[model samples]
Target: MSGHSRLVELVPLYALDALDPSEAASLESHLEDCEACRAELDVHRNVAAQLVPDEPPAIHVWDRIEAAISQGDEGEVIDFGAERARRRGNPFNWMLATAAVVALVFAGVLVGQRLAFDGLSTDEGVVAAAESAAEEPGALVGDFLVDDVAVARVVLSKDGLGYVIPTDALDTLDPSRTYQLWVLTPDEVAISAGVLGADPGPATFTWKGDIAGFALTREVAGGVVSSAGDVVSVILDT
Candidate 1:
C-alpha cells in the first residue's frame, strides 16, 4: 500500500491509541493536511467516546494503579522531576497520560476482547466488511431521519451486508435501554438486525433477501425478540 493508504488503514488503531509511537507520529503529521483522514479520525473518535461509560471509573481500577505504583520493580530507578517537567511542557504528553488512564479503566471491563455491540461484534472482520461494502458496486447509502431531520446513515451492499453509522443528533439512552437496528421488508415485516448499545455507534449486520429500508428503535437493553419500542429513525430504500 502507498503511504496514504497505509495511514488510512492505521486510522482505527490510531483512534484507539493502539498505534506505535513512530506510526502515530507519521499519521498525525499526515492528518494535518488530509481532510478525509481527519474526518475519518473524528468518526472513529466519536464512536470511541460514545463507547466509554458515563459513570466514573471503578474503584478497583484506582486500587490496582496504586498497588502497581507502590510495588514498582525492585531495582527500577526513575527521575520523577524530569518526567513531570517533560509532561508539563508537552500538551500531547498530557493527552497520552489521559489516554493511558482511560486505557487502564477500560482494561478492567474489556479484558482484551472485542466490543460486542447489539449482539454484533465490532471486530476487525466486521469493520472490514463495512469498508468493503462501501467500496463495492451497487451499494446503497441513505440517511435515517427523525421528523425529517437526518440522525444517522446506513449502507447496504449487494451482498446483504449492512452498516449503520449514527450522528450526534441521535440521543444516548440510559443503562436500561439501547438502540436496535431493524431490516424492513417490502411487506413491512421487520427483522432484527442487531441491538446497538445505549449510545449507538457504528455497527455491522447481515441480511438476506430484499429490504425495503432500515429502522432504528430504542429498546430495553439486551434488546427484544420483537421490538416493543417506537421507531426513532428510518431510511427508506429509495
Candidate 2:
C-alpha cells in the first residue's frame, strides 16, 4: 500500500525490526542504492551517538542492535518530536534575526557619524577620514585594496630609512612583468620604492627618499616604467 512512502514511516519499523525477513532484506537492498536513505540513516546514527547514560553500562554500544530496533516502541517518541520542533524553529529563524541585528548596527553607525559632524561643513567627513588615515601607521601607506577591489599591497624600502606601501591594481599587469613604485618630486626623483605583485605585505625594505610622485607602472624586473598605470593613487603632498 504505497504511492510515495514517508521516510518517517520507515523509521519506527526500522528501529524495531518490525518488518519480516523478506521485507527487511528488500529495505536493506533499497537503502544501499539510495542516497536519501543513507543520508537519513547517517543523521540518526549521529544523533543516537550523542545520547548519554546517567549510569554507564559495561556493554559495548554496537552490541546493542536493539537500541535502533526499539525506536518507535515507546513513550520516547514525544521527546524526539519536541526536540525536532525546537531544532527547526532555532536554525531557520536565526537568519532573519541576524539580518535584523546587522541592519540596526549599520543604522547606529550612520547616526553616530552624522552626530560627529553636526557642526563641521563642506566634506568634513572626508577631512576627518584623511586625518584619521594619517594617524594610522598603515593608512598613510595606503597600499592595499583600492575602491573595494583586490590588489597587491606593495612595500618598498632601502638603506633602512624605510619604505612606502602602494596599492597597485593587479588586473593591469601582464603575464611576464610587474609594476614598480617610483619616488619623485617637482625637482628630483630618486628612490625605487618597490616592485609590485604579492599580497599579505610584500617584502619589507630599508628605503630612503622623499616620495613625491609615488607612481606605479609596468616594467621589467628591477622595475622601470615610462608611464604609470591609469589606476594611479597619486598624493600631491609636495
Best by lDDT: 1
Compared with the true structure, what per-residue lDDT tens digits does model 1 show for residues 72-167? 443122122243445454322222232211100112232343222233323455555655565556666656666555566676777777787766
lDDT tens per residue, model 2, 70-138: 642441221212333365543212222222111001122222232121222234444344333333332
* Candidate 1 runs further than 4 Å off: 1-132
Stretches > 4 Å off in candidate 2: 1-140, 143-160, 163-169, 186-190, 197-201, 225-231
lDDT of each: 0.62, 0.38
- The 10-residue segment with the lowest total lDDT in model 1: 99-108
Candidate 1: the clashing residue pairs are 118-195
Minimal lDDT window, size 10, model 2 = 99-108
Give the lDDT of residue 166 in candidate 1. 67
The C-alpha TM-scores of every prediction are: 0.45, 0.30
